[model samples]
Target: MEVSYKEEVSVGALVILGLVAFTLGMFWLTGRSIVSKGIGVDVVFKDVSGLKEGDPVRVSGVTKGRVARVHLDKVGKVIVTIQVSSDVRPHADASAAVASADFLGAKYVAYNPGAKDEPLAQGTPIPGVAEEQFADIASRAASNASQLIENVNRGLNPGQLAADLHNTLVVTQRGMKALSEASNGPMVQQTTQTLKTVQNVMARIDSVLGTRDAAASGRRLDTLTANLGQLSAHLAAATKSLNELLTTMNKGEGTLGRMATDTMLYKNLNATLAALSSLLTDLKERPGRYLTVKVF
Candidate 1:
């Protein structure tokens, strides 16, 4: 019996489907995953403490997936990539820790999905807290402290420290002595005399300007300025009066102005004087002619 080409194709497709279903069923029963068809989350740890690939990754103690890879990052930190189920989403406050799977020393990643109402913390590396050996660190710290104390004890020199303090005190005493001598020196005296001379000169200048006692009264400068202003006002009034007199003389208006500038007034005065002189001469000459007849 020969099979048709269509039947062969159908059989092949069926076989593929059966294999996929069987694979899925097996994964479901054994709680194991072959390929990651879910989310890949990167977690960072300073130390993994023997955690390696294929270790189970748990979500709050429930196993969700397995570790995908383990490697050192650029900064010397251990980066553990875990493939978790699609439904296992971590919130912003989610954290991971390298936990002990059993007493046999098997390690796994313990993930905690924080508050559901919080924002989803997908992408970026989640920092994992590695179990640091506190006892080892404390022991090393004690040893270092003891060594440091020993080093300090060996390096200390009591005599040298006392000598240094004595030297500092001696230097301070010398500095104080020098400062005292400088204050009493001739240079300081000369500076004081120069300052006194400057004060005397300023006093003399104040006396000369008539301002030495001006504060008791008013400022000499201000008084002088006021006197000058009054003088200027008087001079301005005199100038205005002189200008008015000159203007009146030019217009032949006042008594002196008419005498100086009115030609018609001058002519009238001269004519009146001549008439008086002629009448006086006529009276003197006619008095004898009239007196002879009267005496007979």
Candidate 2:
């Protein structure tokens, strides 16, 4: 009986200790102050973005308080009550903002202690600003993607591009077929034959001029040039001789020069001609007497 009593007492004591530890752990996890010396500050926001009670209240990235409760005001705004430690002396203009704490929707209230020497009074309402939420960012990104897709649909019509390409290919094929037909026509064939004949004639002329008759033509040209040189030399010597003869005549050294330059010889020749003319006149009148004496 004594042993059974001791065991029962030990089990009851263990049960009470376990209950005490469980309660203390629950209080700590829920952010309930074991000592209630903290001051309460009211924070109002348009949106909390999943901030709830027991979330940490941070000042300059350090936790100095916790959100005590969250509710809505009369004008339909979110009001979060923050319990700040008495040691933290935030100014009267201290403000609050909600921010994401993790990948989950867990959030916290960020405090900004304004630059003032005076501390904020208890129950003073601190203004809270709504921070951008991941959900809002994702929604905006989705909306922009939708708008981009719509713009792509409006700007680029693949069917039109394909139709234009097909038309261009058809025109190119027609042009190629026309070219082929032109190349095989009769006029084209005649032109090709004529060009071939002209090419062959030009080749033969080139061969003759380059090899077969080149030496003979060069020899004939040399002989003609020599004959022209001899003719030029003979003409120059004849011109010199004629020039000498003209010089002697002009100097009164020959018969023609004396006749041209002597005045006395010219007067004597004139008198002799006059005498002969008078003798001829006398003979013509007495021609019968002269003729009878001559006959005896």
Candidate 3:
């Protein structure tokens, strides 16, 4: 009976140990515990606030990893090292920001996995994101509220405000009365007459534009049409002559074509031009000896 009791106690102890081991294994597999098996990244924060070891690291509100360690560097800044799962690549653009989980000052590192092309390596430092503290926001709100209250106090003058409002109401009432008067009787009749005058002027202009005499008001248009027709015929003849000239030039038939294509014609033309220039110079110096002018 003593041996059976001892055996039962031993079995109970073994079962408890197995349960504990199973729980630990499950935690490790689910990445709940701080294990040094995965990729590590470092982040520097201005203030750790209430962040601690084994705190979950979230990416866009989803838990991806945990904070492995938090320590102060030589410069006295809080340097936090986080271990994330190897499956997720935290790129270089990934930022670390402190976020509160509850009112109990429980803070965690939140990450933004930005720009997929640049995957962060082991021991890489993530850039810190600017976090607005609740205290600072509350202080700013209080200051703004105080300023608004001061502005209201400065602007609130009951007597002057009442007088201004009364004056504005009186002016508005008078303006409404004037507008009502203008919309009725003789004023409306005058507006109608003006509109009718405008309509009549527009009708007259339309009639003038539609009239045959108005269409033929200027003789310059007829003259221009005749001149354009003659110019067009002359241009057509000139174009035909130009085409024939181009054809003759292409066949090297004219003097200009020979001058363009033949080197001998170019030399002869050059000599002739030089000789003509010299004869003109001599005739200008001694005009009567070069030629006698006879009027018959």
Candidate 4:
């Protein structure tokens, strides 16, 4: 009876162990291995989107690791811890990125090895690049479009829009009417006549400057310019001679120059003129007395 009871207990214990092993096997098959041991590398991402724990981490498309944990940091970025295998050596400058596994939105981490010979130290926080998932993007775009449509429906008023359009048309109509009235006024006619006159004057000027007359006028202009140049040269020579004559006169070299510069000569000439004037006055006033004595 004791041997049978021990055999029953051993069988029961074996059955329980089998069940536990099956459960572990099932979890391991589903990529939730309890015995997974590797170095944990923290990676930060702005958005992980569809990435989750137990997602396979790949190096050059080969599965070498798995994501251990995913959480948000203090600054709201998605912090994902990747558990890399002990055999694989990822560089320090290696980068981590998220990728879609299939069209069903399963995501995984993609590792890019850096060119460094040294491997990344354990527990190092690597930078993560958030690749945009097509599904997520399409979903967000659809959601945003739906939200925009709802906002438009809530905020837009058809009646107010129509009224604003009507007011704008009214303002435009009044402006057009004012412009039409100004265009039809006498000022417009006067401006038109002035413009016509200016056009006629311009036509006349064009006729005067026709090709044949232009050549003839050009020759005449050349002759006039030549004559002006000669005149200018002659004027310059005359001015130089006049300057020399003025310099000679200033030096009292000529009779006119001496008379102009000599103060004593001027005083003597004034005295002689005064004496002649006085004798002329006396002869005019006493002409009868002098003539009578000569006649007797």
Write down the RMSD of candidate 4 (Cα, Å): 29.8
Q: Candidate 3, which segments miss by more than 4 Å at Cα?
A: 1-35, 74-76, 157-296
Summarize candidate 4's per-residue lDDT along 1-296 as a digit string, tens digits.
25798899999999999999999887776576687687778888988977888899998889988888999876659899888886665688988999888889888999876778888786677899988879668999999999999899778878888888986775455445444645744445555555565565555455546647667768756655565565556556556655765576568666445555555765687799999999889889988755665444
lDDT of 2 at 152: 93
lDDT for each residue of candidate 1 in 71-170, tens digit (9 for 90 to 100):
9976659998888787877667767899887768788888875666775555777778987555567899999999999888778877788888986775
Q: Cα RMSD (Å) per model?
A: 37.8, 39.3, 31.4, 29.8
lDDT score, residue 81, model 2? 83
lDDT of 2: 0.74
What is the lDDT ranking, best to worst?
4, 2, 1, 3
lDDT of each: 0.73, 0.74, 0.71, 0.75
Between 1 and 3, whose lDDT is larger?
1
Clashing pairs in 3: none
Which stretches in model 1 have alpha-carbon errors above 4 Å? 1-32, 133-296
| Top-lDDT candidate index | 4
